[model samples]
Target: MQQRTLDILDKVLYGLIIALFVVIPFSEAGINIFAGLILIVLVATFVITRSVRGLDRGIWQPILALLIAGLLSLFFAADKGRGLHKFLSPLVKYVTVFVAVALTARTDSRRRWLTAIMLVTGLISAGYGIYQYGWLSIRRVYSFSYNPNVVAGYFAVLTALSVGLLTGVKSRLWQFVFSCTTLLGLGATVVTFSRGAIIGLVASGFVLFTMLMSKAKNKKAVLVVSLIICVVLVALTPDMLFQRFRQIADLENSSNRQRILLWQTAWDMFLDSPIVGQGPGGFSAQYEKFRLPGAGDFVSAHSVFLQVLAELGLLGFGACLWLGVLICRVIYAQLSTSDQDLEFGISLGTLLAAVTVLIHGLVDTAFLRTLVGTSMCCLAGLAYSIGLHHKDESSETVSP
Candidate 1:
């Protein structure tokens, strides 16, 4: 009876995880509801089985530190009540989903299912964005989000993941699916006209190509083919997109100037409360006081790292760095392993996905949005699980 109950709970946990991934790209409310349920189910699983085999300390430790830092920063916020709300809703919620998914999606089969879901949903979203841009005469496609930039960042990460999967998987069918997903994701990102997203996608693509070349049997052939593809893609790109890229350096561009002002404001906020900072949601609350003379009214710092530093101070920033370092360490270790199979491809893809978020985050608040942030965290968790599982199997084999 106990064994049966545990099996049932495990099934429930897996179902909830699937549901969470399905709704992630569509609705923030869905994320909240499903994430909450998953957490509850995860806790129940822990209590029933009295086991924490897959939940690694390396994964949770930095997250716990960030949470603690955010909590402490709340005391220094301009509006403590709002800070508390911000801390609980997205900050705490993101952490919960990350840990829960890592624990539940332990096996290769489960992780592959989740990745397929993400690719399908991402493709659908990208298709919708393309339809809006071409048929509906929309200037910028936002997809499911209100802001085009947010959706751009989301698509950019998916693009990197698709590329990673394309190179990693052995199956031709899966490769074709990822190929379509990658192209559509790139198209969706272009329609959004977000320079930051494009820059990030390019950077991550370079990293992916480099990694692939390192593992390829014929390096010269790979390099030549990659160059040819790049040239073809560049030739096919629309003139309008090229113009948008040029605007990144245009001083006359209002958006570019505004972002600079917002970044400056974030710096001012950090200077004011260097220790703990202004707390969660502190940037918007204290924006007026720190706003540059000609800067327009805005909420976010427009940069993830800057916003974290401004809100949670150096301590919170350090915690974030800690988390990033740990994730890189785990993924790198996994990539170093001998097996270059589907799981290896996944680790490579997730690591590049993270690179997209971090690079885009430098120019836009990519990681602050719920969908993008949680999605990246989910991928990170999956990568962590893969690394740990491989290590355990190796240990068992060596012990015998």
Candidate 2:
């Protein structure tokens, strides 16, 4: 009876995870609803099992550090209520989603199912964006998100992940599916006309090709195929979009100037309270005071790293850095030890996804947004779960 109950709860938990991923691109409220349900199920599972046996300590340590820093920064926040709210909703909520999915997805079959769901949902979202661009005559496709840049960043991560899966997976069918996903993702990302996201996609793609080429059997094929794809994507790009790309380095561009101003304001905020900074959500509260003359009002610092430095100070920023380092270590370790199988593909995909978010985050709020942040956390957790599974399998093999 107990086993049956556990099995039922497991199914429910997995169902909620699938729902969360499907809703990510379409609705924010849905994300909250499903994430809340996932947490409830996770808590119930812990109560019934009375064990947190498979949780990875290495990853959780940095996660805990970040939470601690956020909590501590709340004391120094300009508005304690706002700080507390930010801490709990995004910080605590995102961590809950990460740990829940990581703990529940303990099998290869489960991981594959989750990956397929992500691919399908990503395809749907990108397809819609393409429709908006071509049929609806939208200038820049935002899909369901408020900002085109946000969706672009989201698509950029998916594009890199799809490419990684394409290179790493062994099945021709799965490769073809990922190939379609990559093309749609690339198309949607370009239509959004987000310079930061495009730059991130390029950077992450370079990293992905480089890593895959190192272990790839047919190096020339990889290089030739990659170049051909680039050429095709460029040739297919609309003239207006091509002009937008050319404006990235133009200092006279209005958007670029505004971004420069926002970055400066963020730096000033960081320098003001270098230790703990102004606390969670501090950037917005302090923006007016630090805004340069003629600078327009804005909420976010526009860069994840700058925002962290401004809000949490060096302490919080350092905790974030620590978490990033640990994540990279785990992914790299798995890549080094694993064969060119599905697990390797998943790990490679996760690594490039992180790369996309981090690179885009340099000039935009990539990881700070709900959609992108939650998605990245889920992917990271899945990678950690895979690592734990590998460890468990090794232990079972060695045991009598």
Candidate 3:
């Protein structure tokens, strides 16, 4: 029963990895909700018939709280359609991530392979950004729902993950691929002209610095390459990058103004509703009606943190925070341990990058949106794999 349970969970995880990396990216494929449903069913079956691992215990209350929050939000939501879509969609996605990671995190070797695939996909995704910059100047490449800011933030996180993997690498060949992938991803980050990406990149670097200080392995090499990358990024895109950073200092800029307004609007909604929010998807639609005629369309709350708070209120926001802290603590605990080298480093990098993206989320909603849900899920899975590896290794060490 135990062996069969492991085999089933392993297949579910590998299947998820392949679907996200291989099937989703190469074409106009939507991540079928059916796949997630099947996986959940399988998990339920395993828990019922076999002795399941206890890793999922950490996530149980958080997931339950999020679901409860989502359900409660429906009663107060101004727009039921928008609320249902927004709340339910993320609820489903986050649950998938929690289950997938908890079940499959078992071995260091498995974690390495997971990192390999995400980094490789990051490179391929960067190709689209490159195309957008060069030939797809027709504005169709990243238009409407897929704006430049979103792409920049998304790839910024990707670049950080790739860099983390590069540092985490053991083999010479893998190390070379990391360098190539980082350059390509960094190139894509440049083209997006996303100011938020720069902030995320900086935050991710700080996390990397913490890792370096703790492990203190490759000091000179990390410093030299990092300096060179920083110089080139600044020198190459001096105007666009500098202007965005400057906007942070000078809040008079239009983009800065827009973000403030969106935040204010969210605040207004939350203040009025207080206990219950304006509803999950209701923010965009309701916000536009209050704006002047002929004004631009307001699609999102801009900040994921505010977006959740405004829509779900204190209860929902608390649940989200709970889940986030659990994942971070679990992964960081593994990374901080002195068990394995490459696998620990990979998990450290992934968790850092994932946390960086959440920080980016405070400014942008790339992962929270459906368009990029698969990408975010894959990143979370990568982090979970890292944690699982450590758990497996520690168990092995104590077996004797």
Candidate 4:
């Protein structure tokens, strides 16, 4: 009876996760309520069972470390209330979904289904973005997200997922669907005019191509053809897209100058504390004293690494670094041990998506927003969980 109850909870959790993505486009309140419910379920199930089944300790350690670091930083935080409410709390929620999915989606089929759900949801979001561009004639379509850049970041990850689905799934029909979604997703991302997202997508594509061709029979030929195709595509890119790319090198662009000012202010914030820094959620309140004239309104460091260092200080920075290292290690193991073609393709695609986020983070706070961060965290946890299961299975096979 207990086993049956847990099994039912597993399905419930999966459904709720899918619902979270579907509701993301419609309402922030809906997403928040859904996340709150997920947390309640996670806690209640754990308390009732008195056992954390499928905890995936290896993946949990880095998360635990980061949590501890955040908790400790609260003592030195400039605004403990803001830090706890705005920064730390959301992070905790992100981890909750991560751990919940890791524990629940322990099987290959479950993971694949979750990935499929995410891909489909992404396609829906892309459709909305396309509609905004084609029908409404919005200059930079943001869809349901708060801003164009956030939507771009979200689509950047989706573009990678679409590629993963196209390469991993064997069915011709599914592949065709995924391929079309990939094209649409790319179009949506391009229409956002988000330079950071565009660069990140290109970088992720390169990573995916390299991973896919690593063991191919004709690696050199594939590389040559791929380079030629890339060159041709660049030549054929829309003039508006080229104009955006040109802005990357133009400091005279108002946005670029503002970003530089923000960076300078962020550095000043770090210099003030240097240890725990201003603490989580302190940037906005503290940045005013250091703001330069004509810098425009801004609240964040705009770079994930800089934000962590400024808010959490060196300790938080170290914690984030540790998490990054652990994630990469787990992904490497998954790719190395994946015995099936589908598994390899899926793992490779997931890896590239993660790389895209990290690359995008250099220029923008890509993961700070609720929509982008939550989805990325869930995907990371799922990937790590799958890796652990596959590793254990491989060990069992070799033990005999």
Candidate 5:
């Protein structure tokens, strides 16, 4: 009877996770609802199972520190109530999703199932983007997302996942499928015309290809096909895409100038509060006071690292950095010892997804958006879980 109850809770948790990936792209309310359900089920599962065995508990330490920093920053917040709400709500959502995935997805097949759902979600979003571009003549496709950059960043991660899947899956049929999705995702990313997204996609793609080159048997064929697709995409791209490249070096570019000004203001805010920061949601509220002369109207700092510095100060920023380093260390260890192709696929896909988002985050709030951050936390959770559950006799260790 106990076993049956545990099985039922596991299935429910998995279903909610699937719901989260599917609805997050389309509806914010849906994400909230599904995430809440997952949290409830996760609690029940934890109590009934009466154990946290096989879950990677190490990743939680840095996350806990970051949360503590955020909570403490509220002491200096302009509006303490808003700061507390802002800080805790998303943190709870991110932690809930991470815990749900890490605990529920115990087996390799279960992990792959989650990835498959993510791929399907990406494909659906990409298809919508293609439709918007081809039929509506939209120059930049945002699809269901709020901004073209957000959709582009999302696709950059998906494209990396597809590349990882291409080499990781053993079956020829699945490889072909992943290849098709890769091209589709890339096409959608191109239509978005997001410069940061493109750069991140390229960086992650290079990593994925390099990893595959060392392991996969059909490396030459994959390289040839990928190059051919790249050439075709370049030829078919609109003049606006080329214009974006040309404007890259031009500091006077409207958006580029704005980001520079915002970054300057962020530095000033950091100087004012070298620790703890202005508090959660404080950057936008306090941005005008710190705004530089001739700066345009803006709410966000437009860069994740700068925004964190302005809002959280150095202590919170350090905690965030520590969290990132811990995650990277966990992934590195997993990738180093992964003997199975399945583990390779999960680790590579997770790594590329993270790297792509982080690269994009350098120039934009890629990791701060609700959906993106949640996705990122979940990916890290998946990698951490895989590392913990790895069947090898040797145990993986991370030093403090």
Candidate 6:
């Protein structure tokens, strides 16, 4: 009976992950918040049971680490209340994501379903971006989302997921789907006019080609052909692509000029509060005092690392670095293991997505909002489960 209950909980968790993507577009409508309540309830029940069982210790280590850092960071924060709230707000949902994916992905089939769901959701969102950017004449000079940077940030992560599955997934159909998703999603990302995303995509592509083709000599040519296709497409639509390309340069772009000011101001904040720094939420609040006279609003540090330093100070920076190392280690483990084809592929895909976020995060505070927040934490669970289950034949978590 206890085992059965776990199985049901796991299913609900996976279901919620899929649902979360569906709700993201409507998140501002108040409906998403309402839906989040349901997810919160499900998570509470699972945690209650799992905590009682005392088996959630290993599964929740990342959460534990971050929680500790958040509390510790608050001690040094300029605004205690702001620091504590910002630290805790995103952390709570992320913990739930870790629990959900970790518990659900103990099986091969479950992992695949997760991958498929990601692909489907990404494809749909990409399609919307295309219409919004192209046909509707929405003028995606900056971003399609509430912010243009978020579009790029989200795309970088999504593209990594699609690319990861290219080498790991087994089914020809799924591989084809992955390929389609990559092309379409990437195309939409460029159209969103997010140069930051473009940089992240380039990093992901480089990583994907090197990792996938380094071993398979025959596939090296395939990688070449794919790169060529991407180039040709961009070249053919240079006008469309150039619209995005134009704004990246400080010399040629007004936005670049503004971002430079933001970066400098962010650095100033870090310098002023080098140790404890301003509270996690204090950056924006205090921006007006330091912002350049001509620069518009006082916004966040566009760079994720900079934001971490400004908000959590040096210790929080160290903690995040440790997490990055651990994620890469787990991804390497999945790549090295030989037994399960699907799990290996899913792990590869999931890791790439995480990699995308890490790279993009360095350039953009992609985690400042909830959409990326939920996605990142869930992917972390997926990576963790892969590492844990690789050696255990008695236990498996489904994903890929």
Which tens-of-lDDT digit does each residue in 1-400 have in candidate 4?
8888887887788788778767765566776787888888887788769866766566667777777777776778877888887553466777787777777677878777777777777788889998998899998999888699988888888887778767777789978887798888888898898888889988988877877698779999889978996897687566888888888899999988988888888888888877776877778877878788888888888888787777877877887788878876776687767766556656666677788888888989978887777777767777777776765677789996
User: What total of clashing residue pairs does each candidate reach?
Assistant: 0, 0, 1, 0, 0, 17
lDDT of 3 at 156: 71
Q: Is candidate 2 or candidate 3 better by lDDT?
A: 2
Span of 10 residues, lowest total lDDT, candidate 3: 138-147
Residue 374 in candidate 5 has what lDDT? Answer: 73
Q: Model 5 segments beyond 4 Å from truth?
A: 1-8, 43-53, 209-233, 391-400
List the pairs of residues colliding in candidate 5: none
> Candidates' TM-scores?
0.94, 0.94, 0.84, 0.92, 0.89, 0.84
Which portions of model 1 show Cα errors greater than 4 Å? Answer: 1-6, 45-51, 338-340, 395-400
Candidate RMSDs in Å, in order, are 2.0, 2.0, 3.6, 2.4, 3.8, 4.1
Write model 1 residue lDDT over 1-400, tens digit each, in one string. 8878878887997898899889888998898898888778777777877865566666677888998899889977889988998898778888877787777677789988998888888888889999999999899899988889999988987888888788777888988877888899999999998888888888887987887798899999989998998998899787888998888879779988998999999998999999799999999988888889889989898899899999999999999899889888878788777275667767887888888888899988978888898888888877777877776777889995
Taking the tens digit of each residue's C-alpha lDDT, what string does model 3 give over 289-350?
54533335677778888878788888888988898788778767766563555655556666
Writing each residue's lDDT as its tens digit, candidate 2 over 1-400 gives 8789888988998889989988888898898899888878877878988855578777778888898889888899988988887787678878888887788788989888888888788888999999999999999999988899898988887887787788777788988877888889999999999888888888878997887698789999999988998898778878987788788789988888898999999999999999888888888887888989867878998899999999988988999899888877887799878764767777888888888888889999867888888888888877778878888889999999
| Model 4 accuracy (lDDT, Cα) | 0.78
Runs of candidate 6 exceeding 4 Å displacement:
1-15, 25-62, 76-81, 141-144, 219-223, 394-400
TM for candidate 3 is 0.84
Off by over 4 Å in 3: 1-13, 24-29, 34-54, 108-110, 135-145, 214-228, 247-252, 288-295, 338-342, 371-373, 389-400
Alpha-carbon lDDT of model 6: 0.65
lDDT of 6 by residue, 289-352 (tens): 7787667775577777787777666666666677667666766776787466666665676666
For residue 295, give model 4's deviation from the true position in Å.
1.9
lDDT of the candidates, in the order given: 0.85, 0.85, 0.67, 0.78, 0.81, 0.65
Error of 2 at 50 (Å): 6.2
